[model samples]
Target: MNLHHNLTKSRLRAAYLVALLTLAYTLSFIDRQILSLLVEPIKHDLSLSDTEISVLQGLAFAVFMGIGGLPIGRLIDRSRRMSIITAGVAFWSVMTAACGLVKGYTGLLLCRMGVGLGESTLTPAAYSVISDSVSPRRLGLAIGVYSMGVYIGAGLALIIGGAVIARLPVDTMILPLLGEMRPWQVVFVAVGLPGLVVALLMMTVREPMRRHDESFAVKIPLSQVFHYLREHRFAFTSLILCQSFAAMSSYTLNAWAPSFFIRSYGWSAAQTGHAYGITIVVSGMLGVVSGGFLGDHLVAKGFVGGRMSLMGAAMICAIPFAASAPLMANPHAALLMLGVITFLITLAIGTGPTALQELLPNRMRGTVNAMAVLTVNLIGLGLGPTIVALLTDYVFADPLKLRDALAWAVPMMMLVAAIFAGLSLKPYARSRSQRLLTQQPVENA
Candidate 1:
């Protein structure tokens, strides 16, 4: 009876922790993605091109995330992780709010860099924290649940932005102290302010115990982390590249789907928001969680490289849909194909991080995760949207041909992703086998 009671309490605690982290993640996405829904208005007001918007969405954010992630990840490994997350949430929240005040491209770009840097503190710490709190068997599902924030925040960004924009006039509105602000500016402030409350809530979280005792006794050097990667260079490189490609494919759609729908289908922002937003949230959440569970099930059945295998399979399955989705003349057909593609692509999101956690020792989790963050964000967030814009502006030289850009880009990326995933399998399995032979019992909270 006591054992059962203790188990229940522990599960409850884990649930709460995952819930809080997920909420922070969701808010981060909202702040990052709200700009997507406001692309047209912001472009009109700022006199910007699609290329400039891509820079704001991708490069500006990616560069800073790449810069900050490694250091922040190292801090998470050696310091009070909860404190780091709290500070990050606070910093990013303020930066997000500051975005509301930006009058031009440079200011907005700088603020976006700030937001990226602040958000860089999140996933590495959260991954390490959650790894310590849950048993290995549950790690994939737990992380999947946490990762749901990506889609949730994304969906909510559209939904909430849609609701707000629907109610407000498209023109500038005057406020008491703020004077005049555009609707997009107001949306930024509205989404950004709530993150402060999330930052406060994060303070209540206690840092869970490290999974290994030696993690407390000895400091792992950054040199050793790199050495380990070099030692398993094939596996690590393949895995990271595979994940980066997968992320690129997904981020491309997320960043541009609103604009695509508006330009191609003649849909209003609110209509696109309600339709596409609901599809993403539902499909993304289901896909992430299902993929994690499937990976876990496969691992239990003795496929040590199950996660990598699933990633390869997902990319291949998504190819047809990716090729077809953007090219559909009927908006309904395009949306249906997009929903299918989202489900398939997102299946790998949670698995990539979970796979990394399984390979690294507790001490190296933060730094390695940070590196993963850097690579994924740079390739995925930094380049994905930019690639599409370049294709639209330079290759097609016609903005209306955005669908052709997507049709060309997404399948090609997914093909590369599949190749990377296949290459990683043998090496990843070998590495996991070696690690498992010396694996210690993970300390569950």
Candidate 2:
């Protein structure tokens, strides 16, 4: 009875830990993504162009995330992941709230950069911790559950921000020392300050003992990681680039879908937010969990490439629906298409990286994931919004023609993503086998 009681307690603790990590991920995304819903207001207030706005939405936030991820990842590998995550959550939460305090485009941009640097600490640490905490058989689902926070936080940011902005008068409020501020600025403060509470909650989760810790006694250089990648260049490159394009599509939609509806269908931000938020929560949440289960199921069934195979298939299959969602004549039809597209595209977001993470030994996992994230953020977050903006601003020179830009970009990116993911299969399988063979001696020791 005591043994059974202990097991139950252990299981519950594991579940609680995962839930906390999921909450952290959700908050991080809310901070990162709220800017999407505020595009027009921010532009008007700051007197910015489409190109300039794109920089704020994409490059300003992403560059630091990409650059800082490497070192943070290294630190995560070397230090206690839980402490890094706790401090990071607090720091990013403060920076997110500071977004409202900024007066100029440069100030907001600097705040965003801070948010990026702080947020960069999360995934490497969270993924590492979750991997360390969960059993191997359940790792993919653990990751998938964690990934759900992305869409949930993003969805809530839109729903909540749009709802708040729509309700508030189009006027500034005088708040003592803060002086006057727009409704949108208020939303940032509201969304960002709550993360501090979460940082406190993280302290409850004990750091799990590191797995495969033998090699970790000494620090591994970045060059060694680069060398490992060089050896399995085809698999890792194909995996990174493939996911990067899919992320490009994902971020593009996140950044612009609301604007598209407002421009094309005359929908209010609140209206779009309410509807899109539901779709994101229902479809996006289901898709993320489904990806994890599917990846694990495939691997269990003895398919090499585990998660990537199913993920690639979905990407290929999703191309038409994803591209068409933006071009629908009826707003309702467009939304329906968006549901399918979102479901399909997001199916791999959690699983793909988790699959890759499983391929690595624990010591190098953080750095490897950091590199992967750098590619995802630099290529995906860094360029997704900008590409669409470039087309609307220069290629078409009409905001109304945004649908055309989406139609062109989404399909192209997804198709290329599918091809590369498929190409990664044999290489990934071979690499996994080799890694397993290499690890046998250590495990036996």
Best by TM-score: 1
**On residues 123-206, what C-alpha lDDT tens digit does candidate 1 reach at each position?**
999999999888789999999999999999999999998888899897899977887999888888888999999999988877
| Clashing pairs for predicted structure model 2, backbone only | none
lDDT of 2 by residue, 1-445 (tens): 9978866776677788889999999999889888888888888888887778888888878899878898889998899888999998999899988999988988898999999999999998888888777777788898999999989988988898889888888989887777888887898898999999999999988887777777657887888888888898888888888888888888888888888888899988899889887887778899899999999888878886977787788888889897788889999999999888888888967678777876787888889989889999998899989999999999999888989998898888888888888998999899888887876332210
Q: Assess every candidate by TM-score.
A: 0.98, 0.96
Q: What TM-score does prediction 1 earn?
A: 0.98
Candidate 2 positional error at 186, Å: 0.5
- Model 1, which residues run further than 4 Å from truth? 1-4, 215-217, 443-445
Candidate 1 RMSD to the real structure: 1.1
